[model samples]
Structure formats: structure tokens, C-alpha cells
Target: MSSERAAVSALFLLNGLLVGGWSPRIPALMERLGIAESRAGLLVLCLGLGSITVMPLFGAMTARAGSRSAVWLAAWLTAPSLLWISLAPGFWSVAAAVFLFGGTMGGMDVAMNANAVAVERSRARAIMSSCHGFWSLGGVIGAGLGGIVLELAGELGQGLAVTAVFAAGLVWAGPRLLRDPPAPDQPRAPLRLPRSPLPFLLGIVALASMIPEGAILDWAAVYLQKEMGAPLSVAGWGFAGCAATMAVLRFAGDGLRNRFGAVRTMRISALTAMSGLAVAGFAPSAGVAIAGFALAGIGIANLMPIALSAAGNLPGMAAGVGLSVVTMMGYSGILLAPAAIGWLAESFSLGAIYLGLALLLLVPLAMSRLAAAADFGSDTAP
Candidate 1:
């Protein structure tokens, strides 16, 4: 790899690590502050709010600031938010921190994907999944280490302090690895509405596919604990298992695509997901349910990366536009679905909510063939 490619890849790796490290510490923060569980769940909304509200603006930002500058800003902002999360005492202060965290993460996500799209063009190959693979590895390491830190110190502030240091170090290294960005390829103008109908529809597909992942993140533990009688420690492993499977599958997806083609790969993945969720909702035993979650992970592994790869390859549109739309929709599922799941869980059984996630994914599964055939940037199906 070129030094620039190496540099950007390193940044992607670090991004995954930091995001992973932050997750396990969240419960400690909630306990430290005496916040209610529902309130804490609501706080997650702020992060999504930060990410979602500003996403469409990113293509414009890329035009104005260049991708590297945008990444630098995110790195600089992210550390302080981690620090704030550690220090904040009341609800609103922490809420502000969550908002900033989400916003910074949002910008970083868009910028990194933009960088990947650009870098892939320069390389003339599909390697986006590899970058995301590192992200999955980072999450694994971060979550594991965060568990250790929480156990050792029982202080969320200390954990954030550590995160801030690592984040700063990554930021310092970010500028070194950045590739020279292209000249502004589009005119700077009003952020007009998205012109492409297909990107928008694909975005819908992305959103529907992502809801199951969100459920695994936010509600898996609850279902395990409330419904299955698992201990707190074991309950978390529900999501951990799913994430681990996703990381591995995603890391291997490039090869999978190379072997099977994106379309067949997506169809197989969707089938795996649908079956996984069905098994998960009806899992009579804890072990069975966890397996189902892992299956879902394996199924979900490549959809986004493949979708983004396709979008980036679209003939008439800028890769940035296709990516931004697809990304926003995917993130919307992450941002918007947990609460809806919670409502369903309250009104119906947790099983019903999870099963609903499975049902929703069926739409994309049925349409996966359509998604495969549409001109997304390559001759490959799906």
C-alpha cells in the first residue's frame, strides 16, 4: 500500500478502537449519575440527533473544507466530548456531551467514508469492507478494554480520560496518513435536495436492514435479562456475540464477494439474517437465542459495505451523494429504531419487537435481487 493509503487505513483502525472502547463504559456513567434507565436510553437519542441532523450537509462540507480537514475537526472535537462525559454531573451537561459526541462521530463517519471512496477510486479496486473491518476490530478491543477499566477503577471519568488521550494521539497521526484530496469536482451551491431516486430507495433498504443491528445493540441485554434470566454480565454477551460475528464476517467479506459475487452474497446474507432473527425471537433457551444473534450478525455483515460500494460506483451520481444518502438512511435505522423497539417491547413481548425487526428485514431481502441488478457502479449482481 502507498503511505497515504496506510495512513488513512490506520485512522480507520483507530476510529474503530475508540468507538469500541467507549461502549462498555456507558453503564458506569449512568450508575455514577443516578440516571434512570429510560433517561439514559433517551440520552442515546442526542448522539443520533447530532449524527443525523447534519449528515446531508456533509457533501457540502467536503466541497468546502476537503476531507482531511473534516476528519481533523472530528478528532479534535471527539476527545473533549469523551472528557465531558467523564466529568459531567447532571443530565443536561451529559446530554450536551452526547450530542457533541454524536455530531463529531457523524462528521467523522461521513468524512472517513468519503476518504475511502476517494482512495478506492485512486486504487481502482473495492477495499471499503477492509476499512470497516478495522472498525469492527477497534470496537472489539475498545469494548473489552472498557470492561477492564470499568472493573478496575469503577470510574467512568478515568475511562474517558484514557479515551481522550488515545483519541488525541490518533488525531495527531491523522494528518500524516491523509491522501491529497481531489480538487472540488462539483460547484459549491445551496445544498439542494437529493436528485437521484434510486439512491433514496436504496437508502430505505439500508435503513430497514440496519434495524436488527440496532436491536442487538440496545435491547439484546434486556431480552436476555428480563426474558431469559441471564445475569448482567452474561446479558451483555448477547450483543457482544453478535458484534464479534459481524466483525469477523465483515473482515472476510471482500473474499466472500470475490468468490460468490455481491448479489449472491447479499441474497445469502439476507436469508441468514431472516432465519437468524426468526430463530432468535423463538429461542427457547439462552444459548439458542445467542446463536440466533450471531447468525444475524453474519447475515448483516456485508450489506452496508456492499451497498456503499455500489452507491459509490453509480454512473450518473457523485460517489459522495450516493454514499451520503445511503449512510444517512443506515444511521437513521441505528438512531431511530431503538425507541420504537422499546415501545413495542413495552406494548407487546420483547419477542414481538425482535420478530418485527426480522419482519422488516424481509422487505430488503425480497428486494435484494432488485438491489443487486440496479446499476450501482459495477457489473456485479447485488
Candidate 2:
């Protein structure tokens, strides 16, 4: 409702648009590059690698320059880099382009989230979930528009170029609508990684949550199409259902957390994740799998945002630095999920991966108490 809220929401949308716009076209990109499926997977890994490597550095930069300047710089870097990656002429070039693109995305992610934390603190209540809701909405828009562009123009490059332009336009308009943080010239303590173990606990919770989330994103369609004999056209419904549910629920997450508190929310959500993935893993029909994926989306939707909020607000640390550490660890889980699942799929089954990740969600369930205590510092968990 505030200008800072509007600006931060816009940036969240921009990030989602850029990332989702390119995602639907990945198969085409690999085909263009004459790369095998395995190699394409590796290239995706490179993107995550780039993001993880640079997140902490960007966090420090955000600390020094304030999230305002850091976000603007990220916008500038992201647009052109996305365009370049879309038009890459070869596999290696695509790899390099995606690395840069991922770095900028990572930078934007930290800066924008840091900004969101500031905005939330200014409001003195919960709003992070709503901010993330806008991101989910943007992903829906980007994916739908990207799919349309593919149909109309028959070139992923053109769609991505258009997305890049839109992202740049948003960047140009952002400062006008958004409130700025303190000036970069303001004297502040230099950024440092957290020394306390609390952030690590938060990061572990985030890592556990992200593995299943990423697995659903990267493999849901594959599981439906290949394992269940669903039509290729319909296989995407698994992810679509998940995304739709996630969007809706995240908009409501703050209210739930406010009413029930983080610990109970975490516990219920993790149990939902476990059940949903288990259902999907053992599903006999594509419809059931899609439904399961939707449930899983509901479960996983708010955990990352909640973890991030907890991280940024951790006592006795700079917000940006604390956020970056958790983000890096979470991204590691995301990066590991797809590649590790793929490897396991060679010998085991995608269903096995789903079930494995489902079991892993318990780690967060176990850690939810820690998250509650760290953030609220109360026995509000039960």
C-alpha cells in the first residue's frame, strides 16, 4: 500500500518475469545448441553456481550502498544479460550468458528482499508473504506471455528480448514509485558473515524446504509425462497447478503466520509437503500427481520467505549479510535437487526422488522450533 511496498513488489515481479519467461523455452534453447539432455542439466547447474558464488558479494554491496543502489545496479545487469543469454549462439555461450544472468538475478534477489525487509520493518508487521505473492503472479504472467510469444513468433529469442525490454522499463520506473533506503554515503559497519549458529539453523531449514520446492519445479512435468504416460501438453499441468496454488496461498501466508505463529505454520506446512509428495510419488494417475503437486506447492510456498524474514531479522547481525548466508545455503539445496534427482533417476526412479525429498522435509519440521525461538524468542511454537 506504501510506495516502498509498491516498488519492492514491482522488483519481485520483474525478477519472476525474467526468470519464468526464459524457463518455458529451455528445451528449445538446448535444441538450438545441439546439447544433450544431461549437458543441458549441467548448464542449468552453472546458472545456480553463478548465483551462489555472487550472492554474498552482492549482500555486502547492498550493505555498503543500501538496497536502493544495489537493486538499480541489478536491474541494469539483468536485462541485457537475459537478452544475451536468449540469443546465445552456442552451448558454451549459453552457459556463460546464463551464469551472468543468474548472477544478476541473484543480486536482484538479495537487494529486493533486503528492501522488502526494510519496508516490512517500517510497517511493523507482516508483508513479506504478500510481496512474494506478487512474484508468483508475475511468474504466471511471464509464463503465459512467453508461451503466447512462442506460439505467435516461433522463436524463444524474440520472447526473451521482449521480456528483457519489459524488465528494463520496470527498472526505469522503479525509483519513481519506491522509497529509498539510507544513502550509500551513510556511515555503517562493514558487512560480515554471521558468526552465530542461529543463521545456520535458519539456513538449514531453508535448505530442507528448497530441495522439494526445486524438485517440483524441475521434475514435476517430467514425472507426469514420462512416468505416467500423460500427454506432453498436459504434463505441464503439474507445475502449473503447483504454481497457481503457491501464488494463492502465499498471499495468505502472512495472515496464517500472524494468527497461528511461525512454528505451528512451519509444522503444518512441512507435514503437508511430506504428504503431498508422498501422494505424488505413489500416484497411479496424472490427475492425482497434479493434485499432489498443488498440495506440495501449498506446503512449500511460504517457508522460503519465512526463512528469509527470519534470517534478515536475526539478532546481532547486519540484515543483508545474514540474508545472504541463508540464501546461499538455500540455493545450494535448489541446485543440488535437480542434478541429484536426475542422477538418482538413472538408477532409481523419479518417484523415489519425490519420496526422498518428502522425507527430507522432516528436517524442517524438526527445526521449526528453532526458527520460532530465533525470530520470536518465545515459546510460541506449540
Candidate 3:
């Protein structure tokens, strides 16, 4: 169990670091290509599109191959894709690279969570939140490192160089991950699409939770720099701070979920995220706004993990299939976030965009009860 846990944890950490490596450098990418917020969003959207395209297929493949083979294959592809993002010279080139990056990420995301789900069930306890906590910790470190690189050599040089190192590390660590628990030694039917609305309901919860979180990851620094007039070095702190808070909360989330149940846990989280986004939008200074982001981080921390856990445990659905569906939807929110926020920014202030996102939190707040109310463990066949 300990070895398996460590392997999954490593994958989570690598995924977070590879992805987080890009967040703090968004402004640099924009400046280098001389693109507007909206255009940058279109490029980012390609990444999301690629993920959406690949996730369901990857999920199906995970069902057939199990997670161990899927994890190694995805990790190999993801590492090079990160390096691709670092070195791309033009807008189209960057966009193309990121599309591949997102595709590989989709595969990794589903496999790792499916692996975690298997581990959790085998152990007969709660560990999903803590597993996600490692991802947040990696995010915090990666964002901080990117900020430092940005301050020194800017995006194309130091940022790319450092990220390449992290990507290489992921390749090295890929083989250490544990295999998915074995299937029953009996022939089974091939994988199929999940027909249950419960997964969709959980996916909606995931999608809503991801919107604010995605906005923070992609746009927080730009907000700090453009709206709040902060320097690049300091701009990344909002996300770093948010990731830090998320790491802490996620580390503690399992206990809270067990004690209070998913419904109450999600309710509190949504409200907290709402309050934080509202405060950040209205904040008077960069520091205050970062505080709000941190607050929002605490609010948004455990949502995806809880949603994925619920989906994986749904009785008849293949764990990978259910997790991939929710992940694809959740990542769609991430894919949409930049463009939506950018378009809204054109019509309104970034502050207004964030405030609007706060209101959007209500959907998840209302729907969170479905996870608790539904019988996730029913014996329905897939």
C-alpha cells in the first residue's frame, strides 16, 4: 500500500509540476507573441480542446490496458510536450504544442485518478484528497519556480530551461508508479460509455468547481499585473498563494469529507470560493486580491478529488470511464475559462469577470448534494 501510494503520489506531483510550469508564464507567452488576452485564450483553448478530444478515448483505453501501461505511455508523451511548449517560437507553434500537451495531460489525469481510486478501495479508507494535495504542493513549487525564472531570464530562456528539467524528471519517475489492481480472472465485456446521469451530475459539479480554479491558474497573474499594476515577480504570488492554501486544505479534506459528508463539505467549499472570488474582484490592492485568491483556493481545494472519488466508486461504471467523463467535463470548464473570462474582460473589467464567476459558484453549491444523495454503490450493471 505504501509503495503504491508513493507511485500514485509521484504521478500526481509530476502532472501538477508539468502543468503548473505554464501558469506563471502566461503573461510572458502573451508578450512574446504580442497577442491580446482574447487571442491568448484562443491558443489556450486549443490545449483544452485537445484534452477534451483525447480524454474519453484514454478512459476507454485505461479500461482495456489498466492504469500501469496507460500511466507510463502518457508520462512519456507529456514530458516531451512540456518541452515543446517551452521552445515554440510563434503563436501557431505554441498553440500546436499546447494542444499536444493537453492531450497527454488528459491521459495522465484519468489514469492517475483511476490508480488512486483503486488504491483507496484496496486500502478501505480515504486518501484521494491527500493524493491531490501532492498535486497542489507541486503546483506551489512549480509556480514559485516559474516566477523566479520569469524575474531572471523571462519565459523563452530560464522558464523553458527549468521546465525542461521538470519534464525530464517526470520521464525518470514514470516507471516507479504502481499498476492498477488486477481485474477478476474472468473474461469481461468490452468498455462502453457510461450511461448513468449520476456521473454527469458529478461532472457538472466538477465543471463548476473548475471554472474559478481555472481562472485563477490562467489569469490571476495577468490580473495582478494589468489590473493591480504589480511586477511580474510579484504577479505569480496570487496563484502560488492559492495553490498553497489548496494544498493545506486538500491534505485535510478526507477527514472533513468523512466526518461531514460530501454534501456539507462541498457546500462549505462553494460558499468559501464564492466569498473569496467576490473579495478578490473587489479588493483594493494586489496583496488583498491575492489574499482573496488564497481564500478561494481554500474553498475550491477538494472539489475535483471528491467528485472523482464519487464517480470512480459508482457501482456499475468502470472507474476509469467515470473518472474520465468527469475529468473531461471539468477540463472543459478549464478550456472554456480563459476565453470566457477574456471575452467578458473585453466587455467588463477583469474584476467584473471574476465577480461573475463568483455567482456561478451557486450551481455547484446547489448540486453538491447529489453526490451524497445518490447511491454510488448500487449493483447496477454497466
Candidate 4:
């Protein structure tokens, strides 16, 4: 519980809050603009693009510049991106801003993970899950506030502006908040590429894990509205149900991880996700599908945090690079190829998409165990 760890954890929470706060407003924004569902999806893709662009580059940026500068810059950058989304004049413009926004988010993630690992190493205990739990708290606040703010004027743009104001506050405080420099007790380790077959296998697993999340975030409403024929007002219940489950599970994740260990927690979580996906995908009624998503959310809530903690533990590279690579791969699923999932839904069925993602989780479940075997000394995975 060093000040450095506290600062980074706060930053992590801020990022989650920002996402939850802004993301739910997307449909509102689209409606305000009078755009089609498919087009709105494309615009939302821009945030992914921004994130994807930064993921691959985080390692080098952290290595050359150090955490204080890179991370603070990233935090400041993120707040403004919400404004861009708020003011987007056209689909492409929003897409570009989102791409840049995603990049900042990616960089922030890498630096935060790296810093978290360093703190864990310093403290010599398990804390990553607790830190992540804070992120869950942030999401709860973000989603709640985002919902409230957007409801005020029932205006998406104003919500964006308010979010931007929050971003500005983060920017102002960032310098004072960031660790002055990331100085590991161990001087710079040589950059060993995570060629471990484990990383490659794990990357795919990360992608698969996110597919369900992407679906929850992007497609659930549509599925309820178009497929289940639920009323427009009720459509959002699909995401709300899923997110609520995720938020609750994530808040409790630290307790679970400490009690069961990352490996056991992950294994159980995977099973939950698989079962939830199947139930939701094939449900006969909208209520049933909502229940299924809740199950899926509970299952998935802890998986990503566990996997990310594993990446931080990999011995070869600095935690920053390891996190960057894995994070980049995971976000790639959302940023680059998810639109294709939309295409797939168009041709196939939404049920097909969930099933495909569920099947994909098995790969990660296997890798999660492998990663567990390789994990060093329950030494509090960063």
C-alpha cells in the first residue's frame, strides 16, 4: 500500500469509470444523430482503433520515457477523447477520435499494469485482484453517472462534454499523482520477447474472452430489440443485466482470488462463462437470455483480471511489455475484427456468435492452467 500503488490503482479506476460512463451513452448518441445500428457500430469501433494503435507501442514508450510522463500524458489524453465523441460531426470523425482515445486507454493500461507489478514486487503479497476490484467500483459509478447525466438533457453530446470535464481534472492532477519514475529494484531486464508458446496461446484466449464482452457491450440491446422483439425502452436491460453481474463479481473478485487462488478462480470463471454463453445464446425468452448474460458476466468478470495478472508475472520481459502485448491482442478483438462479428450476425445468427465465442473460451481455459503452472510464487501477481 505504497502511495505509488494507490495512485496507479486510482488511475485504473478512473479509466474504468470513463469507459462505463461514456460507453452506455453510445446508443443515445446514435439516436440523437439519427443513425442506423450498423453505422453506430462502426463509429464505436474508432475507440478500439485508438486503443489498438497504442497497445503495440506501450513497451517502447514506457522504456524510453518512464511512467510519470507516459502515463500522465495518457490520462490527460483520454479525457479529451470523450469530448471528441460528444462533438463528432460525422461517422468517420467520431471513428478517428475514438481510435485516438483507445490508444490513450491502451497506453494507460500498460503503464498501470507495469506499475502494479512493481508495487507487488516491492510489497511481496497478492493485491492485483483487489486493485482490479477498484476498477469494478469505478464501472459501477461510471455507468450509474453516465446513465444519470445522459438522462438530464437526454442529450448524448452534453454527457460527452461533462466527461471531458472530468478528463481535464485528471490531466491537471496527473503529474502530481503518477509515480515520479518507475525504478524497479531490479535494474532494466533485457527485453525478452514473450515467445513462450504460452503467450501466443494466451493471446487468442484473451481475444475469445473479449468476444463475449464485445457482444454484451455492443449487441445485447439489438438482440433484445430485433431478435427477441423486446420494446425499445426495455432493450437496454440486456446490457444492464450483464454489466450488473460483471460489476458485482468484479467487486468480489479479490476475495475470491485470495481464497481460491488465480488458477482455481480462473477455471471456475471459465466454466461459468461457457455455461452462461450457451444459456443466453439459446434462451427461449428475453428474460432467460438476460439471466444467461448475468451468468456469463459472473463467469467472465474475473477471467480477464486473472489473465492480465499472469501476463504481468511472465519472467522474460518487464511487466509493461508483457502487459502491452497481451492487452494489445485482447483489444484487437474489439478494435479490428469485431465489426466482422456484426457481419457474421447479419449472415448467421446472434446465437451463432455467442456459441462461437463460448467455444473459443476453452482455448483460454487450457492456457490459464498452463499459465498457472508457470506462475511464479503466488508472489502477488501484478
Candidate 5:
């Protein structure tokens, strides 16, 4: 179990590392292609489309093959796909590569979360938050280190380094992942949409939580670099700062949820995140904006994990099915935000978009009760 947990954690980290490594390069990618923010956003949208397209199929695959196989398959595909983005010379080529990256990433996201649910169920405890914490930790390393490497090695070098590290991690974690036998009753279809309001509502909560997160991941550096006059080399730290605090709080989130109950924890988290966004949106300087992002991280850290836990435990639904539905819905925020925010930012300001996103938190805050389902196995659930 311990080895399995470690392996899952490593998978989460590697997944995050890939994203983190990519986040810092968005500005450079835009520069290389000589594209406007709107065009870059459309390119980013391709990523979300790819992910959304593949998620349901991956969900079914996870159900039919067991999560370990799904994880390995996605991981193998995901690692090398980064090179496609790094090397693509034109807009169409980059879009195609990003779509492939998003597809693989979406597959891995579903598989790994399913694996985390299995691990949590076996222990009859909450480790989902901690697993995500390792992801944030990886983001910190990826963004922080990636920025340095980008300055020294350029885009291709950074891509190679990230891919190499991910491959090495895969080699180490592959055999250690927990392998569950495929259930005879598992769904074999390529896609299965949610039939219940429960998954949709949970997905809404997850979506609300993830939009800002995706914004931060995809745009925070650009926000810092273009708006605040931060150097390109250091702009990545905006997200690095956010992921740092997110990692810390997420490591502690399971305990908070176990003790305070998921509902109360969610309420507080929503408020904190809202406040953080407001701060960032209104901040006069980059440093303050970074601090605000960190604060937002504290609030945003455990939201999707808790929602995912609830989805996994939904009555009458298979874990993979429920996870896939909610995962696809939640990730839609990532899909939607880049293009929307790009258009909106082109019209208004990025700060305005951040401010607007802060208000969107009310939806999740009002729906906090839904998170109570996350406490399915907890003795301290309220």
C-alpha cells in the first residue's frame, strides 16, 4: 500500500511537472509564433478540446483495464508529447500538438484520480488532497526550475529535460502502481455521459474551482510579464508561488476536511479563494499579485479533490464513470477559460477577468453542501 501510494504520488507529480513546465513557456511560445493573446488562447483551447474529447474514452478504458494500465498508457503517451509543442514551427502545428498533449493529459488525469480513489478506499481514509499536494509540489519544481532552464537551455532543451525526467520517473513508478483486476461488470463503451444530477452538480463545483486554477496555470505568468513588467525569466514565479501555497495547504487539506467536515472546509476555502482573487486583481504591483495568487492557492487547493471524492463515491455509479463525467465537466473550465479570458481580456483587462472569476466562486460556495458526500467513510463527517 505504501509503495502504491508513493507511486501514485509520483504519477501526480510527473503529471503536474509536465503542466508546470509548460506554463512558463506560454509567453515564449506566443513570442515565437508572433501571435496575439487571442490566437494563443485559441491554441490553448485546442488543448481543452483534446482533453474533453478523450476523457470519456479514457474513463471507460480505466473501467475496463483497471487504473494501473490506464495510468501507464497515458503516462507513456503524455511524456513525449511535450516535444511536439516545443518543436512545432507554426500555429496549426502547435495546435495539433497541444491537442494531443491535452488528450493524453486528460486520460492520465482520470486514470490517476481513479487510482487515488482506490488507494483512499483501501485505507478508509483521505489521501486525495495529499496526492494533489504532490502535484502542486511538482508544479513548483517544474515552473521554478523550468524558468531557469528556459533561460539557460532554450525551449527545446527545457522540453527534453522535462521529458527525460518524466520518463525516468515512469520507469521507477511503473511496477509499483497498484493493479486491480478489471471488474466483469465494468463498462466497455468508449464513452458514457453522466445520468444523474449528482455528478453534474459535483462537476459544477469542480468547474468553479478549476477555472481560476486553470487561469493561473495558463496565464498568471503572462499576466506578470506583460502587465507588471516582470522579466520573462521570472514571470513563471507567479504560478510557482500559487502552486507553492497550494501544495502546502493541499498536504494539510485531508486533515482539515476530516476534522472540520467537507462542507465547512469548502465554505472557508471558497471565501479565501475569493479574497485572494480580489487581491490579485486589484494589486498595484507584481509582488502583491504573486502574494494574492498564493492566498488564492490556499482556498483553491482541495476543492476538486473533494468533489472528485464525492463523485467517486456517488451511489449507483461506477467509480470510473462518475469520475469521468465530473472530470470532463471540471476540466471544461480549463477548456473554457483560456479562450474566454483571452477574448474578455482583449476587451477589458486581465485584472477584470480575475475580478470576475472571484465572483464566480459564489456558485461553489452556495453548493458547498454537495461536498459532504466526500466524507463517505469518515467518522468525523458532519
Candidate 6:
């Protein structure tokens, strides 16, 4: 069980490393392809579309093949997809590469989460949040070092470096992943969407929790630089602080959930996140704003993990199917909402956007009772 948990955590970390490593390279990729920002946004939309389109298919695949096979296949495919991005020659080629990247990454995400659920069930306790914490930690390392690598090694070199790391990591961790048996009675369908209200409501909660996180990832630095008059170096700290705090809290969250119960924990988390957004929106200085972002991170850290655990445990639903639905909905906020938020920021102010997201947190807070589904077996309180 411990080995399985560690392996799953490594998978989550590798997934996050790819995403974080890609973040700092976007500008350079755009320049290389001579694509404008508007077109780049459209290209990014392709990535999101690819992920959303394939999620259900991956879910079905996991159900039929077992998550272990799915995880290995997706992880192997991801390295080449990333390499393709570095080799892309034009806007269209880059868009295609990005789409493939998203699809493979999204597939692995579903497979890994499904496996995580299996691991948690085996232990009769909670490990989901700690797995996610490793992911957060990976993102911080990848993003923090990506710029340096890009400058020193160039795009291709950086791509090769990440690919090498993925390969090495897979060699170590892939064999250790929990072998989830394929559902004996699962239909051989190509896709299966969630048909119940419970999964739908849980998806909504995940979506609400993710939007503010997306906003912070995409705009926190700009807000700090423009609105709070921070230097460029310091401006970067907004997301950095948030990611760091999120990583820490995520590591701590499983214990918190075990102690407080999922429903109460989620309610408190929603309120804390709301408060963090309010603080960031109204903060008068960059330092204060970074602190607010960190606070928001603390609140946002465990939300998706808890929601996903609930989704995976839904009665009469296959773990892969339930997870795919919730992840598809939750990821839309991260992958698809940047453009809409940009438009809103242009129309109003980024501060207003933050506060608006703060208000949006109310939806998750109100619906937090749904998270009680995550508390199963030993997770139940006395």
C-alpha cells in the first residue's frame, strides 16, 4: 500500500511537471511560430477541446483495461507528445501538438486519479490530498526552473530534459502502480457520461473551486505588476506563493479531512478561499497581495481532491467514469476559462474579477455537503 501510494504520488508529480515546464515556454513557442496572442489563445483552446473530447473515451478505456495499463500507456505517450511541441514548425503544427499533449495528459490524469481512488480504498483511509500535494510540489519545481533551463539549454534542450526525466521516472514508478482490475461488468462502450444528479452537482463544486485557481494562475502576476506596482521579479511571486502554500496545505489536508470530516472541511476551505480572494482583490500592496494569494492557495488546495474522491466513490458508478466526468468539468475552468476571464478583466478590472470569483466560491460552500460522500470506511467520524 505504501509503495502504491508513493508510485501514484510520483505519477501526479510527473503530470504536474509537464504542465509547469510548458508554462514558461509558451512565449518562446509563440515567437518561434510567429503567432499572435489572439491566435495563441485559439491554439490553447484546441488543447482544452482535445482534453474535454477524449476524457470520456479515456474513462471507458480505464474501465475496460484497468488503470495500470492506462497509466503506463498515457505516461509513455506524453513524452513524445511534448517532444512534438518543441519540433512543431508552424502555428497549425503547434496547435496539433498542443492538442495531442492535452489529450495524453488528460488521459493520464483520469487513469491516475482512478488508481488513487483504488489505493485509498485499499488503505481504508485518505491519501488523495497528499498525492495532489506532490503534484503541486512538482509544478513549483518545474516552473521555477523552466526559465533557467530555457535560457541555458534552449527549447529543444529543455524538452529533451523533461522527456528524459519522464522516462526515468516512469521506469522507476510505473512498475509500482496499483493494478486496478478492469470492471468485470463494465460495458465495452467508447464513452460514458455521468447520468446522475450527484455527479453533476459534484462537478459544479469542482468547477467553482477551480475557477479562482485558474484566475490566479493566469493573472496573479499581471495583477501584482499592474495593480500593485510590483517589479517583474516580485510579481512572479504571486503565483509562486500561492503554489507553495497550496502544496503545503495539500500535504496537510488528508489529516485535516480525517479529523474534521470532508463536508465540514470543504465548507471551511470554501470560506477560506473566499476570504483569500477578497483580500487579494482589495490588497493595497504587492506584498499583501502575495500573502492573499497564499491564503487562497491554502483554501483551494484540497478542494479538487475531495471532490474527486467523492466522485470516484459514487454508488453504482465505475471509478473511472465518475472521475472522468468530474475532472472534465473541473479542468474546463483551468483550461478554458482564461479567455473569458481576460475579456472580463478588459471590461472591468482584474480586482473586480478576483472579487467576482470570491463571490463564485459561495456555490461550492453551499454545496459542500456533497463532499461527505468522500468519507467512506475509516474516514467516517465517530
C-alpha lDDT of all candidate models, in order: 0.69, 0.73, 0.80, 0.67, 0.89, 0.81
Clashing pairs in 5: none
Cα error, candidate 5, residue 216 (Å): 0.7
Which candidate number maximizes TM-score? 5
Q: Which residue segments of model 1 deviate by more than 4 Å? A: 25-37, 155-158, 161-165, 168-173, 180-183, 229-232, 284-287, 369-382
Worst 10 residues of 5 by lDDT: 373-382
- Tell me which of candidates 1 and 6 scores higher on TM-score: 6
Highest lDDT scorer: 5
The number of clashing residue pairs in each candidate reads: 7, 0, 0, 8, 0, 0
Kindly indicate the candidate among 2 and 4 with the higher lDDT.
Answer: 2
lDDT of 2 by residue, 1-382 (tens): 7767887888877776676565555555645677644676666677788888788878887777678778888777787665677677788888898788778888888888888877766676777777787777666665545545655665555555666666676755577544445534333655556679988888899999988876776667667766899754466556667767778888998888888887888888899889889988988899999898888878987888888888877766666777888888887776655766655666777887788889899898988876563245222221
- Distance from true position, residue 235, model 4, in Å? 3.8
Q: Candidate 4: misplaced stretches above 4 Å?
A: 32-37, 144-148, 155-165, 168-196, 229-234, 284-286, 373-377, 380-382
Model 1 residue 320 distance off true place after TM-score fit, in angstroms: 2.2
**Candidate scoring better on TM-score of 1 and 3:** 3
Q: In candidate 6, what are the lDDT values of residues 1-382, reduced to their tens digit?
A: 4899999999998987787676566556656777544565566577777777777777888888888988889889887666898898888888899889888888888899988988888788888999899887877766557656777888788888888898888999988999988877675654546679888889999999988887776667567766788754465567777778889999999999989999998999899999999999988889889899889989999899999999988888888888988998988777677547655655677788898899998988999899988987227421
Per residue, candidate 4 scores C-alpha lDDT tens digits across 1-382 of: 6566677677777776776565466567667767766666676576677777676566556655565666776777676666767677776777777778778888887776666665666666555665666665565566545655666655455455556656654654465444534435323455455666655566676777776777776677667766888754555556666667786787687677767777888888888999998998998888998888878888878777777777767765556666777777776775555556655766777777787778877866776674472235244433
lDDT of 3: 0.80
Off by over 4 Å in 6: 27-38, 187-190, 221-236, 283-286, 377-382
Superposed Cα RMSD, model 1: 3.2
Worst 10-residue lDDT window, candidate 3: 373-382
lDDT of 5 by residue, 139-232 (tens): 9999988888998999899999999999999999999998865545775554557668999999999999999998988889889998999987
Q: Model 6 — which ten-residue stretch has the worst lDDT?
A: 373-382
Candidate 6 residue 261 C-alpha distance from true site, Å: 0.7
Residue 65 C-alpha lDDT in model 4? 56
Please state the error at residue 335 of candidate 5 in Å. 3.1
Model 2 error, position 357 (Å): 1.0
Between candidates 4 and 5, the one scoring higher on TM-score is 5
User: What's the true lDDT of residue 61 in model 2?
Assistant: 77
- How would you encode candidate 3's per-residue C-alpha lDDT over 1-382 as one tens digit per residue? 4877877887788777766777887888888889888887887788788889888877776777787777777777776665677688888999999899889888888888888887777676777888888888888877767778777876566545645775666665566666764344212656566778888988998999998988988889889999999988888888888888999999898888877887788889999999999999999999999999999999999888888888888766678878888999988887666766766666677888889999988988998877662223212222
